[model samples]
Each structure stands twice: as structure tokens, then as C-alpha cells.
Target: MIDGWYWKFIGVGLIIYSMIVGMLVPLKPSIELVAPSAAKTGQQINLEVTGYNTNYSGSASIRAWLKDEEGNAVLSKNVTVINAQNLVANFDIPGFLPSSDRVVPFTLILDHPVDGAMVSPDAVFITQDSISKVEGQTLWQKDIINDLTLNTAFTFPSMSLIRETIRNTFYHVPLWFAMVIIFGAAVYWSIKYLRNPQSYQYDNRAVGFTSVGILFGILGTVTGALWARFVWGSYWSWDIKQIVTAVALLIYMAYFILRNAIEDDDRKGRVAAVYNIFAFVALIPLIFVVPRMMDSLHPGNGGNPGLGANDLDNSMRMIFYPAIIGWIIIGLWLANVRYRLLDIKYNLMNK
Candidate 1:
């Protein structure tokens, strides 16, 4: 009787694990549309929906839908692809009521029967006029480059892979935020280190977190590069975003070189602290300031428009924001583990 009960408990646990994992993992759908967000009013848009049968050896069909703002159906159709992992369904926007109107918004939906999943519609706005509406208000004076919004959306199966990619959030942008935190901590330690070189613990703590921060910096850069490669064509292009990230990473790399060049540990910490303060300052121009001042292939540019209806839809955000938090926590957790391990290694050596 006890053996049977034990097996039952194990079965229950497996069921729960399967549910959680299912939600986390995302299957990659085929590239349906080349440029779904940049359509102009009255223009024909073709959407191709395709995916693989991850579980079975059979074929799959994808249903497509085009909906208006009021959730009224503009178009709906199903396409079946046989023995093929990917399929493309092409359709055209029938044009809005009046051609005189500048911008039109529509949604694209893809349904996968095998997975019993319906990917919510990806929204897009089309315009030929000079002005655009954000939040239903017209902003006429905004520059065309800055005012444009190109929104796109996709769903993938790897949940943990997706979550780790999300660390690109705090790891990418907020590390600068946390680099500010680490540098600020280093400066505090530097001041203390200068006052009393005898207490080396603060100096070590500063070095530990700074090293971890650099690791995070490298991670953010690599992930950004991968993302850019898929979207922007190349892994390492000389675009404004690429240049800024390179400069920021280079600046931190120089900090390590500067530390190694010095003979005395005390002098190294003090000098490095002074230089670390400059890291954030240099980063500001490269990551934030210059990207805005100059034109960039990246989003959120000064002349380029910010995120909008087309860029991020509700379905993407449902996974995206959680990914950001999960990644940030995971990064911090890794950093903390490294910091503690370093502290232990330092103590044993001194002993």
C-alpha cells in the first residue's frame, strides 16, 4: 500500500512540473511577415504563418486573423501545410474606409491547432501623412524620424531561454544603473581605503563587485549583439548602438588594465576607484547621450520614434516583463554567489 502511495505522489509531482515547464517554454513560429509594422494605408500586406511539430511527426495548420481596433474581424482564414514544418499565408489589407486618412491600425493573429494555442494578434499602424497619433492624441510638431513607430511581434517555445534573454533588461540597461551602484560603492570604499590602507576588506569588496559588474556588462553586450544580428543583419555592425556598447565595454576593460599596471594594491584600489567614477560618466555619453544625439538603427533614438503600438503588443509583454525580472534576479543571484566565493577565497589565502 505504501509503495503504491509513493508512486502516486511522484505522479502528481510530475504533472505539476509539466504544467510549469509548459508555460515557460515557447515554440518558435516561422517568419510570417517580413515587415508587418510598416504598412501604409491601402497597402497590401502578406503574412506567412509556419511552425514545426515538436512532439509528433505529423503536419500542422495555422489560422490567421486580421482584426480592427474595436475587435471587429477584418479578415480570417486558415492555411494547411502538408509534411512541411513551416508555412506562409499571404494576405492584403483591404484599405481603410477613406484613403484620405493618414494612419490605420490592425492586428494579426495566428492559431496553432497542434499546440492548442492562439498567438494573440500582432498590432501595426500604417501611415503616409506627416503626423501620427500616440494614445489617441495627435502630435503634429514631432519630427518624422522621431515620430515613426514600427511594431512587430513573435512567440517562442523556450521559456527559460526566453527568460535568460530577458536579463538583457537589467543586465543590459540596468547594469549601467547598477554600474552606477557598484562604482558609487567603489568610491565609498576608495575614500575609506585612502583614509586607512590597513583595512583592506573594503578595497576587496569593491574589487569583487566591480569584477562581477564587468561580467554582467559583457553578458549584456553579447546578448544585445545576438539580438541585433537577428534583427539588424550583422552581429557586429558599426551602428550607433554597437559603437556605444563597444566604447562602454572598452572603458571597463581599460579599468582592469590600469589596475594591473600598478605595483601597490593600495595605490591600485585608490586610483581605480577614481577612474571607476569616470566609467559612468563615459558610459552616459556612449550608451544614452550620443545614441540620442546621432541617428541610430536602434529603437528609442532622438530622431527615431519610441516604443509604441506596433513595437510591443500585449502578448509579448506578458512574457517580456516577467523575463526581465527573472533575469535580473538570476544575474544578481549569480553575482552574489561569485562575491561570496571570492570573499572566502580571499580569507583562506590571507589565513
Candidate 2:
């Protein structure tokens, strides 16, 4: 039986642990902003760098460089650490850009012994009259960027655009995962009820699973919307994933409405069971397959790399995978409680 208090304790404990780890842990040091984003060739430039989770003033051995797609780079002539999270980097722009393009953006890389290395891609664009690759090679290659030390900070990955919202991964993703599993269990019980038409217990269990799954689905949608607002600048962007997920949830909701429409216990159980099974079937394509086929800015969909990529590295996995496990356990426990309540209601109504 899943009624034991021990399982509840374990599930709640893991969930609390996951929440603490997910919220408390910091992201890796990063160059959050580089002001004066453009410069002309042969001009002296001093750009302000606003860093995130960095300690620029703590170390005097700081180095900065601007690099392009090619192997060439221009090292900063002066670096002034204004504070823990702000710095000024000055560079004497080379006479020519290293790239073949007339305009090319350069990445800013900053390294410190205490904070390790942090970068801002396409931080500054330098426009030149010509490519002058050969001449650039002579000028840009003078300062080697090999003196950098690897970052050993224990933190989450600093994803671009996503930034701090990347922490939402632990909650939002795991909730969806748990929802799918709970829905699968609901479908399983529905199948069992269809096989044994005489058992109201299976019907109650199916209802419990469906209700909890719907709750999970709602939470997942809310969390995802909050995450989307950070990266995409809106709560509802009419993205395919959002639309399809809403439709899928609505269809499951109709299942409960269908159950309410029928008053007879045997008939209600049979109809709801059949509808639950069908809803699960529809959910598969709506949530998984259709999202992959369309163009979406949603991470992990439409050929976009999911959490399995660099976004969810070993450090996050410590909180991420455990969160998934904890959510699933809690979902099951909730479903079990819901079914017991339904069973009690069934007995009370008959008595």
C-alpha cells in the first residue's frame, strides 16, 4: 500500500531538498553586459562591463580580451576593476578587422584567478573599411589568450537570454515530467476498469490519477508561462507548445465534465474510463510530437536543444534529476490520497 507515512515523509523531504538547492544555488560567473557595443577601427575604446556573480575587485590579476570567430584576438591594454561586479576594459582597436566581413562582432572574455573566466558573446562590433585578414593576423595575434584558468565554480550554467530564469528548469521541467507519468498511471487504471467493468475501485483510482495529473498540468503551464516571460518577453506568445498544451489540458478537463454528466455509477465509470484512455492518447501527440514538428522558441522543442544539452550539466543534475524523482513520488502519493477520499465518498453515498 502507498498509504504508509514513510513514503509521504520521503517524498516531501526530497521536494523540500530540491527547492532549497534549486533556489539557493547561484549561476556561474558571467559578463552580463558590455556597454559601448560598437567601435571603429584604429580608435581607442573603453567599455564598461557589468558582470553577474563575479568578484572583479577581489583579484588584481584580471585579464580581458576581444576575440572573433577566427583564432585572432586583441588583448585589452587596461583593465580597471571598479567593484565586485563592474569593470572597465580599454582596448586600442587594430587598424583592420580580422574577419572577412566588413562588420564583425567580437566576444569579450575576462579571466580572474578568483572568479575564473567569463565571456560575453558579440559584446562589441568593430566596423572596418576592409577585411585585411593578413594584416590583422600580425596585429591581433600578438597577445596570446592561453593564460586563462578554467572556472571551477560550483553553480548552474549561465545560459544566454535565459540567464537567471534557468533555475526554473528544476521546477518547470520536472513538473511536466511528473504530469506525464501521472497521466500514464491514470490511463493504466482506466484500462483496468474497462477490463473489469464490475470494479468501482479501479474507477476511483482512475479519477484520482486524472485529477492529480490535471493539477500537475496546470502548475506546469503556469511555471512555463513564467519562464517564457523572462526569455520571450510575454506570458502567452501563441507558441505552438503553449497552444497545444492548453488544448491537451482542456480535453482532459472535458473528461471530468463527461463523468459529471452521467449519474449512473456503472455507466459513468465505463464512459469516463474510455474517455480517460483517449485523452492520454491525444496527450502524447499534443505535448510531445506536435511541439517537435513546429517552430518554437521553447527550449527542448522544434529542434532546439533541451535540458539534456549544456543547459543541464552535472551541477544542475544534482538538483534536476532528484527534483524529477521527488515530484513523481509526490504526484503518486497525492493520487493515492485522492483515491482513498473517493473510495470513502463512494461508501458514504451508498450507506
Candidate 3:
């Protein structure tokens, strides 16, 4: 049999390692925000650009462009580097955008040999000037967007909207993953106690795991709240998923309340087991099923790519998978400690 401490050591070591790496790994250069999003054609638009993980003043060969969906681009006449994370690019809007619509969105592209290429989609909109005669070729100045350098550096993706908060994936998501596994393990013990109703030890294990699982759920809630404050602009938006998750946790909290209210050992074990099974039954629909059927602010909801899709690329996957495994192990370790303590209490009480 494997030594108990060996597994515990592995759990602690993996968590420490993954946490260090996840926090330390830098994000690739990306545009965080652009001001004055609209400009009329046949005018010069000075864009105030904000960047993440970008070095603006470091390189002299910084180039900028405003590209349309149809592969057409307008080059910036001058790029003024304000600092490391700020810059201003001046674009002379063409007389007419090559589009059917009166207003067209343009993606802002910045290229530096050191920072490589960073793009912010739909950063600015260009509206056609119907009063002026449409002359695209002459207004564009024949400048081409070419020879852009590629970012070969090893860094996490810095996407717009989410930006730096992407780092929360390592903690927020894996906490839920670990919480589910911990609760599932508790359910297993609950089922075992149900099969052999006389065994108080099985009840001990179930309660212990459930206790830590609730703690994990609370932590997940806090982290998720913090993340929401950043991305969704509110700590609690009363999103359907958030509401369901809160309800699920409250149901689990009652498991302990029921156990505490009971006087007899045998009665508590039987009641908690049956309740736990029902609670688990309720958990699935509350967290996963109900949220999908309704509107939710979370990713992968409302026809967006999931956690494993465009958001999490290869680099994130490397840390993300390890973080999941590490967190699961740590949660199990905590559950084991909890059950052992309960075992001690039970032994003392019996004696």
C-alpha cells in the first residue's frame, strides 16, 4: 500500500508548483481598450490605445493599422508612444469604407518586433461621409500593412474584455472541479452508510467530506464573486447560474444542520444519507442543466465557446490541467484529514 503521507506530500507539492507557475507566467501583448470608438470618413482619427503586457516606448519600429472585415486596411500616419502600456495612433480615415453599411467596425492592429502583433477586434468604427465624394484610393495614401513580426515568446493569451482576469481560470474553475469531486466522494460514503445503516464510520466519512466540500464551494463563490466584479462589472449580477449555485450550497449546508439537530446516531446517519442522495440529484440540474436552459453571464453560456475552447489555448491548458489535478488532490487530502479527525472523535465518544 502507498504511504499516506506520500500522497499528501504529492498533493501539497503539486498545488504549490501549479500555483507558482500560474501566477508567474506572463500574458502575451494585447490591446485592453481603445477610446473614441467612432470616426467619420474623410477625417483624421486620433485613437487613445491602452495595452496589456505591452512595451510601447521600448521599440522604435512600432506600427499600427485599422483593418476592416473585408481584409482591407488603413495605415496610421503617426504612432505616439506615451509609455510602456499606452500609445496614440493617428489614422486618416478614407473617404468611404468598402462596405454596404453606413458604419463599419475596424480592428486595431499593433506590431512591434519585441511585443509581436496584438489585435483588438472592433476597436473603432468608421462611418461613411455621404456629403463628401467617395474617393478611397487617394485618401488611403497607398500605405500597406505588411512585414509584421510574430510574437514567438512563451506567454498566456491576453484577450480583450477578459484580459488579465483570465488568470482566475486556474483557481476559480478548478475550485469547482475539486468541489464536485469532493462532493461526489461524500455521496459515495453516503451511499455506503445507507447500504450498511449500522456503520457510524461511513456516516463520519460522509459528513467529513461534505464539510470540506461546502468550504470549497464557499471559496469558489468568493473567487467567482471577485471575478464577476472584474469581468461582469458586479459582484453579484443575480445570474441564473450564480443563483442556482448558491441554492445548491445552502442545501448542502442544511445537511450539517440536520445532523446537528438529530439526537440519535442511527437516526442521523439514515436521514443524512437519504437527504444527501437527493441533494446530489438536485445539484446536477442546478449547476449544469438549469443554467444552460436559461440566460447566464458565464462563458460557454448563450452560444459562446466553453472553457476548453478559444479561451483556453495550449499554454493555458498546460497549467489548467495540472491545476485541476493538484486542486483535486488537495481537496481529497483535506477530506481525508477531516474524516480522520471525526474517526478520533467517534472513538473517544464510544469509549
lDDT for model 3, please. 0.84
* C-alpha lDDT of residue 209 in model 2: 90
Local distance difference test, each candidate: 0.52, 0.87, 0.84
TM-score: model 2 vs. ground truth: 0.96
What stretches of model 3 exceed 4 Å from their correct place?
A: 1-3, 131-145, 303-308
Model 3: what TM-score?
0.90
Q: What is the per-residue lDDT of model 2 for residues 1-351, given as tens digits with 9 covering 90 to 100?
A: 454588777778888988998898888888888999999999999989999888899999799999988758888999999999999999999998766688889999998997788888999989998678788778888458877878876888886788888888888999989999999999999999999988788999999999999999999999888888878999999988889989999999999999999999899999999999899999998888887777887776335523436567888889888888899999989899899999899899989
> Mind giving the per-residue lDDT tens digits that candidate 1 earns over 201-301?
66665566567667767776677788667666788888876787788878878888998999886688788777876775687667656776777777553
Off by over 4 Å in 1: 1-188, 191-197, 301-351
The RMSD of every model to the true structure, in order and in angstroms, is 11.8, 1.6, 2.7
Q: After superposition, which runs of candidate 2 have C-alpha atoms over 4 Å from their true positions?
A: 301-308
* Model 3, span 187-240: residue lDDT tens: 999999999987788888898889888998999999999999989899999988
